[model samples]
Target: MSSSKAGSSLLDGSGGIQPISEPKAGPRYIYYRIYTKQGALESNNPIYSNDRFISRIVSRSVAPPHTAACLKKHIFRIEKFELSTKCTLYSSLSDQAPVEDSARLALRGISGPGVSEIDPVVLVVDVSDAKKRSKVTSVEAKDLVEWSPTRRYVYYRVYDEAGEISSKTAFDDTDSCLGRVGTLCISPPYTALSLKYCIMGAEGVSPDRVCNLFEDEGGENTMKDGDTVALLSDNYPGVSKEEPLAIVYALQKDPVNPSEQSNFTKKLIVTVYGTWGDYDHTWHTTKAGEIFHTDGILLKKPYVTDSEFACYAAINSSGKKAFIHQVYSSFG
Candidate 1:
């Protein structure tokens, strides 16, 4: 993979892609390539052997930042190769990005049907980088972006429940706020751990499966610090690769079914890991049957007028069953 392809000056020995030499070792970069064997775009990234892994195939200017993306994954692969050279990169829209985000949000205390979440790392905005000529756009909960706080950047889900994209403030608290909100971390290749509402989530509405969104809008706060965010369904993340994290979701009791019964209610819990911010985080259910966490506690939480009282549940750090199942208990 490294040797120049014979007879081809531009390519290496096997006629594979080649990296232009850096006489001075420019800024540093990581390259990803796409070798199409067939079909439309792929569902997974490609694999490259140690001998075939082209670590040297990249430009120095934007190398380091780009390589950082593959940090969690060992291989960025042949398809990712283009990512190395391409200045602009979009996330895998289908499943990879959603599952990752769903996992992040699920662990953060946000779960239930139709909840499309995202990693907070991608929400980051570094005002310090204003000089880098980077334009800031409110990242979608659906976009494939990551965050690095050490680099003074963060990925935030800034949109409102009404489907309004978040606007930014020049205030310095942006950094500290993200940090206090658990949206920022100090790890070396540090990244944000935030979640967003997944717009393209499961559509199966089971009668026995209780979901509290529009009816439970802006209510319920059961998340605490040090807990996980689960991206799952009661069947917790069905078709989410059927992975363990894919099977995590908040367990709703009481109104487990039969919406006609006024005594039925909804709650939130973590069935997955690293989907939301943390257990200490508070949450509210929207009219859309989606759950969200917030640092700003609501004065008088929303409620269902029906006789059915709802409660949210989650496995605490100590594995205790915690929930705000009763409206009266919640107020107290």
Candidate 2:
């Protein structure tokens, strides 16, 4: 090669082409301001006459193209500003057309060389409906109150079985009880099941175990699972620590299998303690003079009657069917 000048070489000693360095570019940004008003747009008064200035927003130039709706939502999220359902954004005080949600900011001359820190694009919002909503929300918050009910306490006693209280000896003897006497604090509208659970917890018994609750110590006037505690107290008043309500552990009977139940039929010899006849003529009647015999009796179905007690359907000895009041007959 010809004699190469010391400073004329374009390549380095590695035989690779040398690259030229360029100057670094500065960061770019879009700047804008927001203003809000709480009334209808007026041409004579002008939107910027008495408008309130919100925070100024600065966005990077490299960000994706933004629409009016997108920018409004972003401002709402960043500023935690609430807007009403019916509101609109305007580019200038004199602008007759509102900025559409899909309209691009760049296309609308909101962001470009014309926009600057001193002469930034201004966004105006009409929040007349928003003011109404805010007022309503404030009033509702001021009127809100917490719900609280008065607490009441009730005392109860537990027995091993119904027979224990039936003889009245268990009521007089503390040693005859299944557990020590317990008290329950109840609020109105409490259910009987909830009371049972409280008693079960006090007696240290399993929750799955069944317990029968009565309003009286004699175990009469049974309390159903759905009965309200307030109603039960109304029916039987004057329950105190000296005379507490009675609770008995129900005897657990083995469940009859469906297959065995299908192959077998049960017949009960019921004795009528009083003379009763079905006034509705839907079923037969029973006379106290004769011992009524039935082939099969359906006791599960609830018969609607004026009597306070429940009624059951039974087939009489003469093959006649009738509904019998539960209190008039004794099943053997």
Per lDDT, the best of the predicted structures is 2
What would the per-residue lDDT of candidate 1 be over residues 1-332, giving only the tens digit for each residue? 33434546456655566788745423322332211111012113212221121122223232223333442122233222222221212221112222232132111113321122222222111211212332232433344333332222222222223332322321344332111011112111111112211210112222122222210112333222222333221221111211211111245344322233233233333232221221112322112222322122223322222233344442232223223333322220
lDDT of each: 0.24, 0.44
Can you list the residue pairs that collide in candidate 2? 283-321, 283-322, 284-321, 284-322
- Report the lDDT tens digits of candidate 2 across residue range 1-332: 43354334546654455787865433334334443321122111111222212123455422356677766665554434464333355553324345787777652234442144333334444333233332111223234333232323455666665455322223345444523221222211244554565555556564445567788677678876555565234333114555567777767555433234432233434455331331123333444444433334435433324334355555445444455665565554
The estimated TM-scores of all candidates read 0.20, 0.26
Prediction 1 global C-alpha lDDT: 0.24
Runs with alpha carbons beyond 4 Å of true place in candidate 1: 1-27, 31-43, 46-255, 261-332
